[model samples]
Target: MLAKHSKNKKISDKAFITSGKAKLAISKYGKENVINATLGVLYNDLEEIYTFDIVDQEYRKLSSQDLYGYASSITGDENFKTSVKKIVLGENIESNFPNIYTDVISTPGGTGAIYNTFKNYIEYGDKVLLPNFMWSSYKLISGEAGGGYDCYSLFDSKNNFNLLSFEKKVLELSEIQKNLVIVINDPCQNPTGYTLTEDEWEKIMDILKRACKKTNIVLLNDIAYRDFDNKALEFKNIFKDIPENLLIIIAFSISKSFCSYGLRVGAQLALSSSHRVIEQFREASAYTCRGIWSNVSRAGMQMLSNIILNKNKYLELKIELDKSIKLLKRRSDIFINESKDIGLKILPYKSGFFITIPFKKGIDSKVSLELEKKNIFALVMEEGIRIAICSIPSHKFKGLASKIKEVLIEIE
Candidate 1:
């Protein structure tokens, strides 16, 4: 039966089916017994141990009526709709996010939101542009949607987003394809943890604008970890004057931001020049959501709405989350700085949980396996290892770095 199902499906032959680093690390260390710094998971103050007194009571007081029911029913609830609108507009502008939207669809997770957004817009065989080094899911999801996806190489030794390479890809794609979608993740990028410089972002936006002027392009900005970095900036204002012909979709999630991984709550904001176009896209998106997960959890949506609605609660949560972010940053600094001090080459890490360390010539897999012997496991990406700095205690980072150094020396 499984063989028949596989034969019927049109799976992509070009797909890379290797297991991820997180799994390898877990396997080597044993799932229940690993000092895993391989996944970008927050590991502090996660419990609701401290009560907010009245706020706790208020949260408990909320009934089903108070929460937005379905995606289509969101606008009917005046208060819920208003809060969401405020979040999308610049009214309650936070550090990283600026533009807010009037209509937003709640989804099960960031991946769900991405799936729905792509399903709404992309047709079979349509091509989407993505950076080569992106979350592995982008290609998988695009292929599942029956869309042809292409990569704009970011193979620079500096590990930065190359504007010239991006432009060349965009121009080449425009010559061949009529419709394209470009995806970008900022702040703490996955795998490499590299962030774009302000100048690089400006050039990228310019390239996007120029490409959109010539051909139809959709900009899908996945701000999953937008709040991870203290130095992160808002670019919504910069995109305000973008061509009306272009469609911008923002995928937001609280999993990484609030450490609410199990909740699986996320929202998708679709921006377009035409209200009619937005409405049509939303209908398609809603259908896709219903087909996939039926509906998002009421409890998760209520928790997020409650926190955002109460200013004091929001501030308190922000402080707690900031503490965790700072801890992760400190750990990342120690690992990266120590590697540099010891004359070890590391991929440029600007603002993410991961730092990629390339192995000395011919020493990638051998070093990784040897570290496994020492109870140290990391995600090996291509010829490098992706260190999950956010997963380790700040005090443990130096010791871990030293272990990795020792392994590298042995392999060399």
Candidate 2:
């Protein structure tokens, strides 16, 4: 017999099995011949994993105390918290959100930030709202926190953020639950790369204003892929002067940004109108930290803090990140343009690590089998096929979109 909550647990995610299939295909064929695009991690044209030189150098320079000693606080080092805000809000922090009081609590990764928010805010048996196309982890995190999740249609007929459907779902959910947690993965959403325009953000806040009248709003903004965004810190201004009843949590991750995915450095950024609400967030989050992972990586926190606090290292890191962002954009351009040439329609992909192409639901298995037979591997989801542009080489991207279209045609 299993624990009551553990009885219904999933054995493994489809992505993992799909990836295993890709690896097996590579073994059967050859690495150079296979297009393994199942992972979200960045890779170079040579099919090697990418990491920042600065992060590697700094980590090696840290003392044993910095590496092995416990952090200054269970929440995190105070200076590390300050550095995270500076990096997130940008050098001109005053202009980002003059009215909102902010607080930070370090976590394992963006996953920890989102899970902590759900564990504290989500009531048992209630539900959080997510985009219909999202990282599968949101559902897992919600379940672990004793809650369920629903979704709003992510795109309209024209392939823009579906505000009407979003508002409808929010109102419908509010009617049933007193507290509502809506997860918005934007700038670069998972699987589907869609970014909301400034006007769209305004409309969402406006909807929340009305919805907040009926229920307490806990809006979790997952910005794990935000470093690739071309909009930069300009998007931070959207949260300024939000309603007091609405709490905003920014899921910040150093994993992708610093290539420290194994180190697991991340933080939960809380924004609200009332200072008291932020303080409550700090207390409740720290308690969760104590109960869960205890404390995050000291060396990882120290390294990130140092890079941000020092002018030279900060510039160096920024330069490196900017290069990766540009590289990702270029790869996306190749796929988007080639897909258009082949008449293969893609979802609205503003910027991100992955791009999605919609197809009939029942054709995924056949399409995936065909792709693997041709030594091409990609994530097959319910809505579409996900191409990890970050992991795929630019040269390889040139013809991938067409091949996928060909597969779809064959299967259909």
Q: Number of the top candidate by TM-score?
A: 2
Tens digits of per-residue lDDT, candidate 2, 1-412, equal: 9999899897577777877988887788878778888888888888888988998899999999999999999999998999988877766665667777889999999999999999999999999999888898899999999999999999899888899999999999989898999999877889898888888998999999899999999988888888888674364657766888899988999878887778998999888888999999999999999999999999999999888999999899888989999999899998898988889999988887899999877777787788887778788887788888888888887678878888888888
lDDT of each: 0.67, 0.88
- How well does candidate 1 match the true structure in TM-score terms? 0.82
Clashing pairs in 1: 88-99, 88-100, 88-101, 89-100
Taking all chains together, each candidate's TM-score versus the true structure is 0.82, 0.97
* Model 1 misplacement above 4 A: 2-34, 45-89, 92-102, 359-367, 406-412
Q: How displaced is residue 398 in candidate 1, in Å?
A: 1.4
Tell me the tens digit of each residue's lDDT in model 1 across 66-141: 4445533431223433444444443644333333222577776788778876776666788778876667678768
Best by lDDT: 2
What does the lDDT come to for candidate 1?
0.67
Clashes within 3 Å, all models in order: 4, 0
lDDT of 2: 0.88
